[model samples]
Target: MTLKNFKVLGILLLLLAVFAVGGKKVSAAVEDRDVQYTIGVVVYNQNSPEMNMFMNYYREYIQQGFPVKFYFSGSINSAEDEINFIRAMKLQGVSGIISFYGQDIQKIVEACDEEEMYYVLGSGSISDEDYDKVKTSPYFLGSVGPDAKADYEAGYNMADYFADADTSSYIVLTGGSSAGNYMHLQRTIGVLEGLAEKEGLTYSEDVEKLASSEKTTVVDAGKDNVSITICPGYMTDPKGINNLKHAFVDRNYDAVLCTFNVDEIMKTITSKEEEQGSNIKVGAVDCFSMENHDEINDNDSFGNPKIDYIAGKYASMGGPAFAILYNAMSGHPEANTDDADSNTVRLYQGFWSASDKDTFNELYGYTQDIYENAYSCADLMKVIKAYSTDTTPDDLKALTEAYTVEDVQKRIEEN
Candidate 1:
């Protein structure tokens, strides 16, 4: 061969060798991440940004890196729906389940136990009564969620914002508290307690009584007589919607504390604020949806941000939850428990709040798909037992507790 041809051949040979080595490495990586376990994810709604982000973390992010496949059971609310989903997943030979269904956990746990599927509470608490029954079950892995205190504080702080500003008149959306929703009960209490602390109004501490109170039950706040009508259910309840409409039309509420689903009344409140000159403020607990995100930045006719307070959660908050389940399913069950005597775990997560546009926009990237997710495989490796040997439940607990927007931002920046 000519010298020039030989030189070109050598260069081509070197490139071929480099490509071969790179291909082998990529193939090996794919082999290492081959699916070995199927995890069924139970959620109440599939349409919201919260659920979208949540499912994305598992299906797109986690599944891309781990030997896990996620099967989502879209929009299961009741015990029957949960039972049916669990049975179907069992028949599909799913190795485990991550349930977001808070209602009737005991039944769900028992159903999971029957199927011998490892179970975890993806979010929400296991009630004290239910906890006692399933805390020792072999199939019950553990739980991570915003506990009652977190829910209450979400309510309290939101209500406190309006109350501290001397906004006496208010309407409270009880979400599902009347239907025995645990999270709603706590938030409802927080709103009432927060208002009481600010306005010196007396209220029944008994959650059940408050949950069942007749609509338009007036709580006497010394000077203005703060009257709050608890609209029992959320949207889709014709009677509840009627009561809510009545409350809005009949009374001039200065603010509304929506413990769940702010969008339910956002339109009405905004229109009232703009057209009727109603100086109504809003605070609520919900996911970081774009429409609401904009409300945090967009001003109304009165030059005030439409949404004043939002106790929110980013989808990455659910990352460590999968980490916990991963440990349990991967033969490191010891790392899933907290107390030595208890077989189950309870990890509390915090909320990300935004009261103004700057505050909301500052943390906006975290909820969006772009921000290096806090619970990415590398980030979770710090807690995953197989990846980080000697990683304890405490490490996972710390991660769950550090789920606030500020903490997540600090973590992302630090990383």
Candidate 2:
């Protein structure tokens, strides 16, 4: 053989050795791809029961399949805090984020966009103006939350429940300041509208004025025999509990309506009723727990429920939010569809309600069949996988539409 032929064979041999060594590393990287992708979760309060439930479910059921590590932000309150947390996550090699609360959404979106990290809004929503600003941003993976109108409707439903219970005289307690949380404001408006629509009910002109102001107001609903008083204020404030106790518990209102912080109100009313033998029925929104359910469903010594009705509690938004984030990170974003605009916002309806022990058990009792079948990780993963397939927004919406125990039962049976 010629010297040139011998050199050519040596070059080929060198190239073959290189491929053998490099191919193993490349294959190993492909197999471990999920390990490199970290997801940051910006939870409002990591210790909250809702957040606990979400994390527990995600780690136990979802993480095994997805194989991604999660970094949690500590109790974020402000937009600046959230942005700093996001930047820190980005620096730490986080590829995607799911934010449970962001008061300053525009800045958060901008920061995520600058970092080229995917962001999914979980359990909260951005304002229309902020959404419009970030609608076109590739980093904004979209939002998953309860419909804003549903908040108003939740208030309306609570009022209607009270009206149906023959509650002629009652008081209303709001959760937070109107300027701080628009959802609370919308719900407060809904409650007023519902009360105004009830037959044989008349509220003071100041009740109508609640649409403009967040101050607590006493609106008289009934005349002589039936009287209703509506008071609105932030439940988190130190003065809020005192005011609520004075207006509802001390004054012995027949019933109480609370749009936010239902747990605090419920506990206060329960304590007051236990001490004073008051039988004030309670209606509230966003208070769904085993204890809250028992309080609402169990009868007192006199055989009447301490609390009456609750709406919008069983709505677990974290599942959908996680699905959105996972899809975006996996390169199968639901927003990529022709029918879904990149800026499209997904809204889930509130459907859970408990009027009696049977219904309460069916909804909140851990041993119940509905509870047994409630939203498994596999079930949620189905929705996540659908984003890349033929699934439409309507199909996606259907997955979250049935939030009540009965509705969930029917959905499970149908499927």
All predictions: root-mean-square deviation over Cα?
12.5, 12.0
Tell me the tens digit of each residue's lDDT in model 2 across 1-415: 6674465455434433543654411122224566746777777765454555455445544455556666666667788768767766665567888887867777888888887888888666667788788887778876776667878898888888888887777677766634567787778778878877875566566543654355555555556766555465666566666667666544566677877646655567777667667577877776455456557666766678776777754424466667667667777766333435573455565636666666666666421222344554555666665434655545556665555566666656655
Name model 2 segments beyond 4 Å from true: 1-37, 206-208, 211-214, 248-250, 274-276, 294-303, 334-336, 339-344, 365-372, 386-394, 402-407
Please give the lDDT score for candidate 2. 0.64
TM-score winner: 1
Q: What is the lDDT of every predicted structure here? A: 0.73, 0.64
Worst 10 residues of 2 by lDDT: 22-31
Error of 2 at 123 (Å): 2.4
| Residue 302 in candidate 2, Cα distance off native in Å | 4.1
Look at candidate 2 and tell me the lDDT of residue 165.
84
* Residue 295 Cα positional deviation in candidate 2, in Å, after optimal superposition: 3.8
Q: Which segments of candidate 1 are over 4 A away from where they belong?
A: 1-33, 202-208, 225-227, 301-303, 338-342, 369-371
Task: At residue 413, give the lDDT of candidate 2.
Answer: 66
